[model samples]
Every structure is written in C-alpha cells, then in structure tokens.
Target: MITISNLKKIYNNVLVVNVPQLEIAKGESVGLVGNNGAGKTTLFRMILDLIRPESGEVISNGEAVAGHENWKNYTASYLDEGFLIDYLTPEEYFYFIGGLHQQTQAHVDDFLSTLTDFFNGEILKKGKYIRDLSKGNQSKVGIASCLLQKPELLMLDEPFANIDPSTQIRLKNMLKSMNKQHGVTTLISSHDLSHITDVCDRILLMEKGRIIKDIATSSSTLAELEDYFAVGQSATLLPQIDEEENH
Candidate 1:
C-alpha cells in the first residue's frame, strides 16, 4: 500500500532518516522498533508527507506522496499529542473529524460505543478540553479519533507509551482485529517489544537513521528483539566509554 525510495531527511547537517527503499503491502501489520534518535518518527513524517524529504519520495497506491492529496483520503495517523485539537473537548474533536470523513454524529457515537472498555470509562463525557486531560488520556483521544476514520492505512507512533496496561491490551486486540478481519493496513512504532510483537506480523528494527533488520514475526521474535536491544545497549555504552578513555 506504501512504497518509499531513496528517502532521506537531514537535520543540522546530520542525516536523521535514510531509507533506500521500503514497502508495505495492503492489510499488513508492520511494527517499527528503535531507540530514541533512531529516526523512526522522521521516517513516518516523510511517509505521511508532514515533512518533505531531502531526497526521493514516498508513494501510496502508485502516486507520489509529496505534493499529493489523494493519499490523505485513505491514510490516518496519530504520531503524538500534536495531532490533537487541544482546545476542543474530546467529543467535539471527534465530531469534527467524523464530519471530515462524511460520517454522521450517530455513526461516530456508535463507533465510540465499541470503545467503552478501551476508554476505561475515562474519556467520554469528561467535560474537559483535550488540553486539560492527562497525556495518557490525550493519547486515547488521538487514537480513537484515528479509528473513527476507518482508514485504509493506519500509522501510529509510540501508541503504547502512555495508556495503562489494560487499555494497551485492548488496543492490541483492536489493531489485530483491524488487520486480520477488517484488512486495515497498519504501521505502528512502539518501544514496548512484547506488545508490538504480539500485534504486528512483521517487525522492522531501525538504528542510526536506517532500517537494520526486517524480520517476520515468529515465536521467538520477542526474544530476538530483547537480545538485540540488551546487547546493543552494552555495545553502545562501551564504545562511548572507550572513546572517553582514549581522549
């Protein structure tokens, strides 16, 4: 459903994202895993066309994403609280989004009704603007808004970070159902290894602005990721300490 070629983003003369090529098929659930500064968000922004890449292009359904509006019709993304309309109450914001997608208020209400457990009784009818909610609640609002769109391609960054554990579990089930049953193509970036492994069918491990590993999820995917990050932490620290000693 998405293709990227020669994509690159640079900041402060440092290349933050450098994907030579990547492709995501329809109805596939892909997980992006990386530590901070690995350029996962940058890559996502380029794919979403929120930021222009320094080189190359992203293509959705055979059309170049840059300078194109058609992809937005089928794509829904929530990277952070920045995606929210902070001044609006959750209900208002949801209704506004629903209007954009030609969904009636009744449709939105019915959709939200399915999320009672996911919301854990904390999101709706709170009578507070989105800005007043805690970060976790704000995240819930953003995610629910994305789901309201019933998007063909869904991308969420660090979606598992803020909410409580039960909500996280609910979200995983929702995403899995979307991918398997509803055929919603998903790209999720998360630091939580176990949850991502459970939700995604394929995992892409990124480091230093490039995709280093792309593995199809299997029984041992979580263990493999754990080992990589565990050893990776030590390897990174040892290099810095060695450099300091040499200095």
Candidate 2:
C-alpha cells in the first residue's frame, strides 16, 4: 500500500535518509530497527508529509503523498507524544482523531472498547487532560486513538516505549490481532529488538541512513538477528578490554 522511490533527506550537508526504493503491500507488518540517528523517524516523517524530502517521493496506493486528498483517510500515524493534544481528554482525543476520518463518536467508542484489554481501564476514564496523565497512559491514549480509525496504513514509531512490560505484551497481541483480523498494513520502528521480533513479520535494519538488513521473522531466529543487529556489540567487546588491561 505504500511505496517510496529514491527518497533522500539532507541536513547541513549530511544525508539523513536515502532510500532508493521501498514497497509495503497490504496487510504486511514491517519493523524498522536502527540506532538513534539512523533516520527511521526522518523517513517516516517524509512519508507523513511532516517534513518534505529533498528529493524523491512517497506514494500510497499509487497516490503521491504531497497531493493526495484521500491520504488521511487511508493513513494514520503517531510518531511522538507531541501528536497528542495536551488539553484534550482521552475521550476527546479519540473522538477528534476518529472525526478526522469522518467517523462518529460511537465508532471511536466501539474501537476503544475492543481494546479494553490493552488499555487496562486507563484510556477514557482518566479524570484529567492527556498531559496530566502519566507517560504510559498518554501513550495508551495515543495508540488507542490511532487504532480507532481502522486505518489501512498505520505508522507507529516506538510504540513500545514508556509502556509497562505487561501492557507491552498486550500491545504486541493487539497489533498481531489487528493485522490478522483487519489486514492493516503497519510500519513500526523501535530500538527494542525483542518487541520487533515478537510482533513484526519482517524486520528492516537501518544504519547511517540506509537499510542494512531486512529479514523475515520466519526465516531467522532472534539470536541470529542479534548477531545481525549487533544489539550489544560494544558490550561484547569488553572481554577484549580485559585482555588489553592484562597486557
């Protein structure tokens, strides 16, 4: 449902994102793994039109992102806490997002109800503005609102961050159900390899603004992925440090 061609973004003479091509078909869940400055968020922002790419284009279902009037209808994205309206209550936030897609409050409520297991009762009943809630609760509201629209393409960055471990498992199950039940195309990015391995069908690794690895979960084990991902490469080198100290 999404395609990117020759996408490039540069800042201060440094290239941040430079994908030559990418395509995500319907009902596929892809995980993006990368270091802090690996340009995952930059790529996502360009796709969402939050930032204009210096060159190339983002297309969804044959429609260019820059001029697609129906883009919002097909795509729902949450990149950071800033996307949530600080003043809006959880109920108001869900309604607002659902209304953007021409959905009614009932639609939003129904969606939220299905996710009660994921929410753990912290979503709509909180007595204060979203900003007043804890970070984890705020994340629940943001993710719940994103799912309320039943979007075809859902782009979530660091969805597992700040969420508790138990709720993280709930979210993983929720995402799996969403893909299997609704055939939603999802693109998620995170530093947590475990979350990506458990939830995503395919994992794409990025380094220095380029895709370094893209592997299907069925084809590889997490330990092999850890070797590929170099999750604790620096830590593993500590033995070498010990040798040097002895020398």
Candidate 3:
C-alpha cells in the first residue's frame, strides 16, 4: 500500500534517513526496530508528509504523499504526545477527530466502548485535559484516537514505552486483531523486541539511517534481534547466525 524511492533526509549535512527503496503491502504488519538515532521516526515523518524528504518521494496507493491529500483519509498515525491537543480533554479530542472522519458521536461512543479494558478505566470521563494525564495515559489517548479513525494504514512509534504491562498486552492484541481480522496495514516502531516480534509478521532492523536487515518473522527472529543488539557493532554477524539457525 506504500512505496518509497530514493528517500533521503539530512540535517546540517548529516544524512539521517537514506532509504533507497521500500514497500509495504496491504494488510501487512511490519515492525521497525533500532537503537537511538536509527532514523525510524524520520522515515515515518517523510511517509506521513509531515516533513519533506531531501531527495525522494513517498508513494501511497500510486500517488505521491508529498503533495497529496488522499492518503490522509486512510492513514492514521500517532508518533508521540505531541500529536495530541494538550488543552483538550480526551473525550473532546476524540469527538473532534470523529467529526473530521464524519463519524457521529454515537459511533465514536460505541467504538470506545470496546476499549474499556484497553483504557483500564482511566481514559474516559476523567475530567482532565490530555496534558494533565500521565505519560502512559496520554499514550493511551493518542492510540485510541487513531483507532477511532478506523484507518487502513496505521503507524505508531514506541507505543510500548509508556503504559503499564497490562495495557501493552491489550494494545498488542488489538494490533494483531486489526491486522488479522480487519486487514489494517500496520507499521510499528518499538524498542521492545518481544512485543514487536509477537505483533508483527516482518521486522526491519535499521541502523545509521539505513535498513541493514529486513527479515520475515520466524521462530528464531527474536533471538537474532537480541544478538544483533547485544553486540552493537557486529551487525555483519547476523547472516551467519541466520544460516546456522536455518540449517
């Protein structure tokens, strides 16, 4: 559903993202894993057109994302708390987003009703603005808002960083269901290896603004990722490990 070509983003002459080509098919769940400064978020921003790429273009459904509005209709993303309107209450923000999608208040309410366990009874009717909530709660609000849009393509950045363990499990289940049953294409970047492996069918390992490894999730994928991260500069060792595992 998305295609990128010759993508490059630089800051002050330092290349931050240098993806030459990448493609995501419809209904695929892809996970991005990397340490700090891997340019995952920069790649996401370029895909969302929130920032213009220095060299290339992001294509969504055959149209350039850089100067197009059509993709916004089916794409929903929550990168951080910055995506939320801090001054607005969670309910108000959700309703506003619902209105933008032409969903009635009743529809939104029904949709939120399914998230009672996911919210853990802390999100709705809290009577506090989004900013007043703790970071975890704020993350919940942002994620809920994205689900409210019923997007075809969903992108989330570090969704497990905040939130309690219970909520993380719930979110993972929700993502899996969205992809398996509802066919929502998902792109999630997370530092949590176990969670990402459980939720995504494919994993992209990025380093130094480049995609160093793109592996289809397998029984040994988690161990491979762990080894790669454990031995920071030994990325060249992954292929040997993979071959050994296969044999």
Candidate 4:
C-alpha cells in the first residue's frame, strides 16, 4: 500500500503539492489527470524519493519511502527520457536495469520476448542507441525496461503520450493484465482522459496542486471528465478544444 500524509512541496514561494492525506491500496490502478503545472510530475517525484518534500511523509508498504532503500526492491518507474541511459543500446540498457533488479540474462530475455509485439520489430537489434531512436520508440523501450524488473509497484508518467495508437492499445492491455494477473500496483499520469479511463479503475483530477476530484471509473466517468474540461476551457485543460468546429 501507498500512503501520503501532510505532503507538501514548494518552489520559489509557490506551492506545488499539498495533500493532507491519500492512500492507494495494493494492486490498485490509479490515474491522475490535470492541466499542465498541476503538480503531477512533482508528486510522482516525491513518491519516488527523487525530490524531497518540504514537509510530510510517503510510506510504501509500511516503510517511510523518503529515507528507505528497501522499497527500491519492489518499485519501478519510467518518468521520461531522463530515466534512460541514452548512450546504451536498448538491449544493453535493459540488461543493466535487469541486473539492478537481480534479474539474469535469461530472465531479461524471457521478459523482452513478451514485448516484441509492443516494440513492433522497430526496437530490438536495431543497432541504434536509445538517443537515436524516435521519441515513440524510446518511450517503448523505457516502458518495457521498467516491466523487466517485475516490480510490485509501477509508476509511469504519461505512458501514452508519444507512442502510436497500435502500441498504445498494446500497452494498455499489457498494464491491465499485469494488474489483474500479477497484482502489480500502478500509478499513471496522463492527459488523455479516454485512455486513462480505459485503463484505470480509479481516476483523480488535480488542479492548482490539489486533488479536487476522485472517482471510481464507471460508464459516466469519461463523459463527466470531458464535461469538466469543456466547461473549464480557461483552466488550461490539455489539448483544449478550439472554438473552431470542423464541418
């Protein structure tokens, strides 16, 4: 389980996050949706212990995540290109990450075999360094690498952003299976309300660094979120619909 209490982050006198309390039970899939600067990435960083909060604590599996190393054994995340080793080829990078998780070469190979369809034959043995791959392919590599660890907790920020539609569907299916079969807990932050609603069992809406709405996914969830964004045009909602209509 994940727990946050009195979490707060400040930057140059501006508050980035302020959540009095929150909890995500084991094996739950949660999606975070918000406009830019809504503090989604900052909050993910805090959860990963990549950044320190001004005050509050994050507990993972009964351990304080802020100053603990045990959580690393069961947690995996892919936030952005910054998380990858650009100099290494995809295979090399995967092996390195696998080793870190105590996975052997055979274990890594078995994991990568399952992702061939997701990679679409464009990633493996391409003889291209990670930096040389297109943004979408790079995203595929990063995501696949994260799963190679077989982590109990998986966190991804915008896993659907740059990938093509086919791969997006593949990833969504993969994540769903992981959650249902392996019982992996997942936290995903995305701008696509449709995709998030499709994959997540629960959704969170954030604005101004605060969670304003939390709802379990249902038939009405997507429409409700769309309505919220439509009426909130001036709120800087993502891919904001323009006034011009296509005829």
| C-alpha RMSD by candidate, in order | 5.3, 6.4, 3.0, 6.4
* 67-176: candidate 4 lDDT, tens digit per residue: 79999999999999999999999999999998887889899999899888999999989899999999999899889988898889999999999999999999999999
| Ranked candidates (TM-score, high to low) | 3, 1, 4, 2
What value of lDDT does candidate 4 attain over all alpha carbons?
0.91
Please give each candidate's TM-score: 0.93, 0.89, 0.95, 0.93
Better of 2 and 4 by TM-score: 4
- Residues 13-100, model 2: lDDT tens digits: 9999999988888899999987799999999999998899899999888899886677888788889889999898888888888778
The CA lDDT at 103 in model 1 is 94
How are the candidates ranked when ordered by lDDT, highest leading? 3, 1, 4, 2
* lDDT top scorer: 3
Higher TM-score: candidate 3 or 4? 3
User: How many steric clashes between backbone atoms does each model show?
Assistant: 0, 0, 0, 0
lDDT of 4 at 48: 97
lDDT of 4 at 205: 85
Error of 3 at 126 (Å): 1.4
lDDT per residue, candidate 3, 1-247, as tens digits? 9999999999999999999989999999999999999999999999999999899899999999877899999999999999999999999999999999999999999999999999999999979999999999999999999999999999999999889999999999999999999999999999999999999999998998988778899998998888889988555556655675588
True-vs-predicted CA distance for residue 60, candidate 2, Å: 0.7
Residue ranges of candidate 1 with Cα displaced over 4 Å = 233-247
